[model samples]
Target: MRLLSFVAVFLFSFSLAEVGFAEENGSSVSEERLTPEELDYLVNEVGNTQEESEDLPVEVSRRLIEEEAQVIDSGSGFMVIYDPEVTKPGQISTFASIAATTLKLGGTVYKVKSDRSKDDKFYIYGNFQWLKTPSYTLVDKMTIGFPSSSGLYLPTSGGKVKQHQHRYSQDQQGNGRWIDYTIKYSPSNWEPSAGVAGSYDIRASTSKTKHKGYIGQYVYVPTSKNGKINIKITYGHRRIAGTPSVSVYPAGLSITPTTATDTRSYALTLSY
Candidate 1:
């Protein structure tokens, strides 16, 4: 069988699925803060899987800067909670696998509902009702590549803590379902105490779900005319930002703009 290129409309199914995964076979339809009963209801029910599809690798899983930790299981797939602080909201998780191996074999994926208007609200989903695709159908086109990332920033030695402006572009297409691009910039962090200057550029992108994504990367290699010359260079950094705000390792540096400055040019500064 071939992979189903499109997914179906997810509606009432979420409620049944959520309850099936919830505690003690319970279903809470009202919108209210979880009481002790509800808390118990949720914690017990969330991320419950079907006892099948337990072995797919997580292609990309990005924990938001201000995201609540979630639980994952073969029956329920993936779940997302909430964070009280550091608020810049987006998806909770993103998961991808070979179409043939996952839903076809016995796995599911869950996406957070954007339109469902309730605080701490989410929905649980499942896939592959008729067993559309098989694992052995497409071995000839198989290739292995790990997702990666590259990042750049302002020169730490410039004493430029000022927030800068920048521009960006993206495109998500084909099976990849992501927007890819190249970025050039200075280091986001500066060590005044040691006077160690650093700068890096990043090329990154994401899919519609944005979690458990992949990045292709190449690092900056510094060139030296003479070993004695102390010149601040625009080299690349291997560590890339996991989200829109900061990188996986932020040493007082932020690559993304807190806000866009000029819409046309798409530029940024060190100090905002």
Candidate 2:
């Protein structure tokens, strides 16, 4: 009797499998209508399929992730990059960073009273930087000067030096003319009562490399015994460090001397 029972159970399972197989392989059972057993089989099979899909891992593409995580421009010569990774709902984290190099120039330029009339002086004050941009190297020459009408003069003012002017050239190529390049100027919130202070953008295209940057602190007639003046200038990037350097004549002499520091920030004081 036990052997007969086992045989009966095995036959029942085999019959159910055969029925499912026939239904899938275009058996004519559907020409009329599904029998109760057939309906039950179909429902259970569909439920199992849905459960399998829900358990499977979702596939994500790398390109899509890169597109979603993008860089945003601050529009003020700065940039911010954002990266996000989402593992599951409510389990997301984002990474953000600033560019290695950025263009920013700021500082003060004004005039202070002096004990002597010939000592009336102008000061170039401020912090300026080219950051990590290659423009520092591409730009071959630079100049800073007051307009002829300003009457302000560099310490080395000579018969040829109409106004206060400073210049730097790369590879000893000599000073370049301002009219040879593209210029851009920005409105500055820093307004000085004694001298004119503003932001200037200079760019040049000579060879394969492109160069551009901002004037950090500029004072047109920064000091005045008597005159309205404007300052225009350029700067050269140091060969080894790729930092900016300015030429100035301090002793009211014709010899222009390079600054004592790097393109990093510095204070300029003018005393009469």
Candidate 3:
């Protein structure tokens, strides 16, 4: 994607070898605090996928990063913010993908909503649904992804997706209706620690009526180098039905701001 392109060009121009891969066995100590409930939730319902390294081939990683992290053309002197929010009752908000454009001054935080009618599921990040049945409790699936940087910080609110279901039973007025099945939520332990190239992968299953949900969030962290460097973000999510989820391995490229005292233009940095 755009971000991957940015990193590729930045890395190629500077001739910096791509960095090392994060170990599969949960290399980074997550600063995100897990609640007893969340701990039990993860341990009992979901397997710790981050601890097992998938060993994405070097060429595959490079190609996937470039193919998925598309760059946005925000023009010169513009800061492109690639952010997305997911919402629903009982589930954590997540950015299935991101949006980008020039940064607005005094508006460092950007907000965008999900539009199901537009097939804008990218904004939703992962697949979520609430199905009904006669004999069984409804089965709901939850997936979450985390970045590989400590500097990232996600706010408690913002991305929200509401859900509704139709019930055949009639109200006092004798009319069938759509019931609000919106799942209320709080943030989870989703933050990244410093200098880790690996992300968190979480998934869980619960009864549809259990009032349990997952919210995945993403926030950008700023980094700098003496010279030009490619800021490649390694993001991961849970694979569903053996099909690879896009958020499971999303990559992007970014350019760190240059200092005023560092008069060397980015082109010059390429030579050094």
Candidate 4:
């Protein structure tokens, strides 16, 4: 798919300028919130996938920061914001806010929403920018990668094609068991772009029996420049016990970026 670009409208007011200053000075900005009409407009813009084309108007983008929305990335000239209201428990809202912001800021948003009640949702947003990238250092089974200007190679459009399998190997011994599993998935082909890499930590539960057991694998692929990373997960019964079923879908992903000062770390949760 051809990626869409947006042109931001110019509409900055004097009052909004004060809000920006307050944010820089670490002061509490006024409680002036987005109006009902404005909020609805934002929700619609973010929710509609077809319109996910370009950057938001300069005025709306600025107001988002002024309202204390969660900042995803500010390093690039275009900033990304998540709706803070949705983060609060018991609050009902749409996930399109972040997706919309990402699209407006010249990125693509990928999501997997499941029908299962306890399913963990996943979203991936990527934008092409020439910033610092991170290099990976492996220690034991865990690897940590820190971003720096002189660190590793720049992330290209595509990544490696590999699969990581996680399965239950214990002998069932003619019995049924319920198991809780937590798995960490590292994209082998992921490289830091401007000091950021995409990774996932997924937790889920499955039932196992003598005839059927839990078996799954995560498939990672590098796509074109517009779609930097692509991941698909297939998990379910290994055998047919009583019409054994399987579910194959995408996993949750997150990207972390360090501030210019390198003192704070900001994690953008793409999952809804």
lDDT (C-alpha, whole model) for all candidates: 0.22, 0.30, 0.24, 0.25
For model 4, name the residue pairs that clash: 6-54, 6-55, 54-104, 55-104, 131-194, 132-194, 132-195, 159-222
TM-score per prediction, in order, is: 0.16, 0.26, 0.22, 0.20
Model 3 residue 128 CA deviation (Å) reads 1.5
lDDT of 3 by residue, 21-110 (tens): 222221222223344554343323332122111211122223323323222211112223332322357876455533332221110011
Model 1, 208-240: lDDT tens per residue?
222111111111112211111111111111212
Top-lDDT candidate index: 2
Q: Please list all clashing residue pairs in model 2, or write none if there are none.
A: 107-126, 114-272, 142-234, 143-233, 143-234, 144-233, 154-164, 155-252, 156-253
Q: What's the TM for model 2?
A: 0.26
lDDT of 4 by residue, 150-232 (tens): 22222233463222211111112323222212222333223342222222112121222211111112211222112222222
Predicted candidate 2 versus true structure: per-residue lDDT over 1-272, tens digit per residue? 99999999999999999877654432312223334443343234322123222211111112112223111110122321111222357764434332234433332334433334445543342223333333223322333333344445333223222112121111112222112122223212111132222222323333332223233222223334553333332233332333233333331111122442123222232322
Error of 2 at 231 (Å): 2.6
Off by over 4 Å in 1: 1-174, 192-272
Q: Poorest 10 consecutive residues of model 1 by lDDT?
A: 138-147
